[model samples]
Target: MVKYADDFKAMVVQEYLRGTIGYKVLAEKHGIKSKNQIVDWVNAYKKFGIEGLFRKRRHEVYSVQFKLDVLSFMKRTGASHAETALHFGLTNPSMIGDWKKKFLEGGAEALDYPKGRPVMSDKAKNVKKNQKPTQQDEMTCEQKLEQENELLRLEVEYLKKLRAFQMDPEGYLEKHKQRYHSNSKKNSD
Candidate 1:
């Protein structure tokens, strides 16, 4: 929405209040897109005088409690967003709508400021800084012993298999071919 100056809004609103011309004709004469904009301005002017028509110079920060209060007031009075904004001296009516949406979606917490990036814990940082690569650091004693035992078992199994293969390479080759052929036939079928 295009922001009109306070004086311009007041002038338009005053002209609108004169009751001679309709909102559509007044909007058309002033090059405003929607008649509702003029209506809103007029409503704001009535409710809040000249101050409601003025745009805020800086961004206004509303606390979570304030947002909740606004929502509660709107619900209690059955007021529209524009009416609620005018009552609260807020420049933008959409802000009340946004607050209502947030409140409905997540209750009160949604109106609070968003949680930013997560911070790393001090213990994690200290651990990372102090850690170094070393043989002992690679594995615990129990892990190292288990790994060595596994390697020895694997080596023994390999030697036994090698001896068996050497003793009967032709027999092993024949058995392997028969096994693979049957498996392949099963797969194809």
Candidate 2:
């Protein structure tokens, strides 16, 4: 699943190791964006040799515990993402960063979240297509009340904002321009 081929990585690593060129020059010559990328490739090459640069055919899934262990190891040892990945035999160091972000935002259970699209078997798809709504799918009294409360709260908030805008459209827009700009930037991206 590697992006760069092993041959290309080897060539870059060898060129860098030759001492005639630095990472920045090599990265620019090869159209790579970051010098850090070359640093990682060279580190991997030095640590694991040519085999480290080879592409993996199959995707590897790490268990939640294994992910937690990797994060903990990094935390304990103060290793960089690339170093931690090499220590753990992980090809992609960015995955460790993602795991750390998810863990920080949602704790260990977030590590258990599935990646990629959900695959439905033929039988399951057929069953889902033919299934009709059942009482079990219906909201309970408390859930119904909660939904109503949420709707009412949103309506009230919308009305208040509408009133403010109606009173002073220019002022309201000026007040909210930053929010609008941020939202537009997100949508554009």
Candidate 3:
């Protein structure tokens, strides 16, 4: 995504409103990639005034319920992403599209987690645990070697499949359809 300065956006919007030039010419003059960018800025300016032109510094986390509500409202009213976003006081309309795509692909549970790395918990910060060694720690050398060999075999199989997927994604997915479905069904059960 391209980040434009608020002043530059305001200037473009102002120039567009002046009515002497259209979006295409203004976009070409200002070296903007898309004419639709001007349209979005103008609409945002009209609906939200100057504050709409400003960039957001921090990400605002929305609840899963809120995302569902936005999607439901869009479906119920048959509103476009831009209209729904404006009604919800959301700065970005594309977020609605993204949510809809995710919901369709993975259902509502997919929206339960937010993007980016999770924060480290206090428990994770502690180096030592108040627990005794497991049975694996007391295993004989022969047993440990057998376990390590089994792990190596699994890793080799995993790498083979990974290479196949990277080489031919569509073919790999088609081949693994049964395995994927079975694993998902087992988890659900």
Candidate 4:
């Protein structure tokens, strides 16, 4: 799956809003792999309020209404799963699918509201205000950790390839050695 930044989505959304480019053209121009992405962004903005379109909220889980509206809009718009995924600022289409199924099964209320974090006492808040992360802060930290893990995994794979080549230094050197030997043989001949 192609992962895109929020700015890219916003840019495509803006271009779309201006009526300058069609979905196909915009997808081609902006490197948007999915045509539904363009449609999703515009439709998402139209479907839900601001939250539906933005990617800044990485910690707080969205309300059930938010998910319902997004899925409902995607269904209404005839956008693909990829577009709906992008619309929700989520990278996973399965999540969109799951929500849609829930909504379908349980009506609009299928998206269940999370049980909120426990309330901290005034003294605890005072201490938390001074130092330490809250549940929300921890959630964001976990998101960051996941993002970093993805980057590290890619980097590790790249490095493993490098190490594989490095481990057989003679394999790389063999090519040059063979070329040199061929040149010397020709010279001698």
Q: lDDT per prediction? A: 0.69, 0.75, 0.74, 0.60
Question: How do the residues 1-189 of candidate 1 rate in per-residue lDDT, one tens digit apiece?
Answer: 587788988999989888899999999999999998998998877766787688767555665545654565466457788777665656688878888787678655566654455568999789879888678667988998996676566445545544655677566545555543453234223
Candidate ordering by lDDT (highest first): 2, 3, 1, 4
Note the residue pairs that clash in candidate 2.
none
After superposing all C-alphas onto the true structure, candidate 3 shows an RMSD in angstroms of 14.3
- Tens-digit lDDT track for model 3 on 62-104? 7665676567557655878877776666768888898889878
Q: Estimated TM-score per prediction?
A: 0.52, 0.61, 0.59, 0.37
- Which whole-number lDDT from 0 to 100 does residue 115 have in model 3? 82
Judging by TM-score against the true structure, name the best candidate: 2
lDDT tens digits by residue: candidate 2, 23-101: 9999999998899889999888887688767666666666665676567556645789998878766667888999999
Better of 1 and 4 by lDDT: 1
Displacement of residue 181 (Cα, Å) in model 1 is 91
Clash list (residue pairs), candidate 1: none
* TM-score result, candidate 1: 0.52
Residue 64 error, candidate 3, Å? 1.7
Ranking by TM-score: 2, 3, 1, 4
Q: Any idea how many clashes model 3 has?
A: 0
